[model samples]
Target: MAIILIADSGSTKAEWCLVEGKKKKTFFTQGLSPYFLTGEQIQNILEEELKQKMKRVMPDEIFFYGTGCANPNNARLVKKAVQKVFTGATVAVDHDLMGAAKALCGREKGIACILGTGSNSCFYNGKKIVKNSPGLGYVLGDEGSGAYLGKKVIQHYLYSTFDADLMDRFDAKFKTSTTEILEAVYKKPLPNRYLANFTVFLAENRGHYMVENIIEDGFNDFFFNHVYKYRESWTLPVNFIGSVAYGFKDVLEEMCHSYELQLGKVMQKPMDGLVKYHTN
Candidate 1:
């Protein structure tokens, strides 16, 4: 029986699935971005995490859909790393956008949006991606994402624009000096993702209007800036995939309704779609 391997890698986590002969297993591992982690680190982490899954089954084909692999150079590096693990196997490396598109649209025509640590969107035409807005990483872009919300939260907090209770809570949780905050924002690697961690606080208290407004603004930014750019005459179905989209589906759906956009579906992860793609 032929074995299949699918990996979805993000800035924070990587999920690996192995399918063979009606038996399947899943594994969780670290991110494997050459831009963020060294080749040796990726090899060590992936080898350790994948060893058990690869013990009795050798995958005939491997599909890697990941965040940092959006760039051609990064995609090549990731492909090389996967090849080292599954030697002689057919390996295809693509940006996480493909996973989102395939998972949401799934060989059907629709708009696929990913709102996680970062945000991105693409228009799919059943067979391929016909249009895509450049994901300007976490900075400058990534509207309707955790990082964007987090940035807004911080901005409001610093400017004394948020509710008093929210400000108090944020100050109590952080309690970090200005220098420390600056260091985290300017001196750290993957600052946007780091900042996105703060959005969890909002998620914890999602009922608060202050938090709600931040999320609303982020989603509105996404719609006005990215999703609405492709103005076709006919209405298009819009689907979403990512942690943020899953966690805040109600809010997203409400926003979509307000904007007169149709919300098609939401997928927490792309693994199910990948399985169907490979097996069926």
Candidate 2:
């Protein structure tokens, strides 16, 4: 029975699972994206939140999967922070993209995708990642992501592109003024995440035709531009691991059918899969 800590993080949330043999306890802390937070800040979060919750029940191994950790430097940054918290424990820090691959595909050959605050896809052949379709962050690309859907919703609202019915519903639901939205997006930190907040409304109103259109267009862009680039996209099983993908599984499956592609697992979070991968 190994004592280990497994984590899955997006730009908005980080989930922690402490496994002592077969018994697992769950904990959640704020998101730790290397793109937004410094190494010292990461350390602070671990110290303040993770340590306090876990107390003295230190794990021998700590596995951290998070956004913006693809870069070697960024991975090292996270490792250093985790090392600070766990002291003698072994730490592994990596990007959420790889997390998606490992969680969805496990030890099987498949294409893995992440469609959370951001988006990414890769071809994994059981043990390693063979091909990658770079997710150009939320600003340039990140198609089919929560941020992307949120962007379209905000665009329609700001430009009055959609009908008054949708606009009125949105306004009534959020009760957010244009100026407030602009301030949160342009002025505050993590505008991508700020924009992703609109996805809650979009998800709630899934039955709306305009919402369906937005979902279809966003997923089409992801499939065509990102997923289709992988050589095994149609040949192997393709799995989705993220909030947006799991939330809109029906729509995502419909898009896959249109491409004559079969879909695989659709996990809302990668923590459980990761725990299984590491423990066994």
Candidate 3:
């Protein structure tokens, strides 16, 4: 039986799906990236997490969409890792941005945007990506992402900018001390993701005005900084793929209205869309 595997690798986690005949199974593992982990480390992790999943079948084709694999060299390195496990299989490795594009836009012509731990936008013209607003990772870009919202929240919290009730609730939930927060930002690896983790606190306490403001600002940032920059005056249907965009659809929609941008649809995961694309 022919098998197909789709791997969506992000900075924080990787999702793997195995489909054979009519049966489908999914597996998740730690992220594999040359920028963050050595080749050997990635191999060990993949072997531990995926070896069991591959025991009964060999995939005939594998599609790898990974973060940090935007560079050809990085993509090649990850592809080599995948090939080790699925020897002789047809493998296609590309950037996660492409995955998001294909998952959201599919064969239709529209804009695909991802707002997650990081954020990015691209113009997909059915067949290929025509224009991309460079993400520049979390440091320089990723505006309107979880990290951006978390950063805003922390800044406001530290400077005593938010209302007293909101600050009290936030501090109580996260208990994020100044020293710990600073260390996470300055000393730890993947600081943006670290900061983004804080947004979960906001999600938990969405009723608070401060958290609402953070989300609103983040969505606005995404609109003005990234999405609008690409298609300023034109009104194109926009589809979003990511946790932030999907979870906060109402907030995003409200912000879109404020910016005069039309809201199209939101997808929680790209894999479902990918499945629909192939099946339908």
Number of the top-ranking candidate, with lDDT as the measure: 2
> Where in model 2 is the C-alpha error above 4 Å?
none
* Tens-digit lDDT track of model 1 for 1-280: 7788889888678888888868888988977766788666777787787766567577899989987787888888888877887786899999888888887777778899999888898888877788898778677899989889888877887788987888788888878666787798999877987778878877887888878888888888998888888663038888998888998899878988888888888988898887887677
Clashing pairs in 2: none
**What would the TM-score be for candidate 1 when compared with the true structure?**
0.92
Identify the superior model by lDDT, candidate 1 or candidate 3: 1
TM-score leaderboard ranking: 2, 3, 1
Superposition error at 158 for model 2 (Å) = 2.4
Worst 10 residues of 2 by lDDT: 5-14
For model 3, name the residue pairs that clash: none
Candidate 2 per-residue lDDT, tens place, 47-136, comes to 998889998998998888887787899899889888987997999888887888888888999999988888889999998888898768
Q: Would you list the rank order by lDDT, best first?
A: 2, 1, 3
Give the CA lDDT, 0 to 100, for residue 97 in model 2. 77
lDDT of 1 at 278: 68
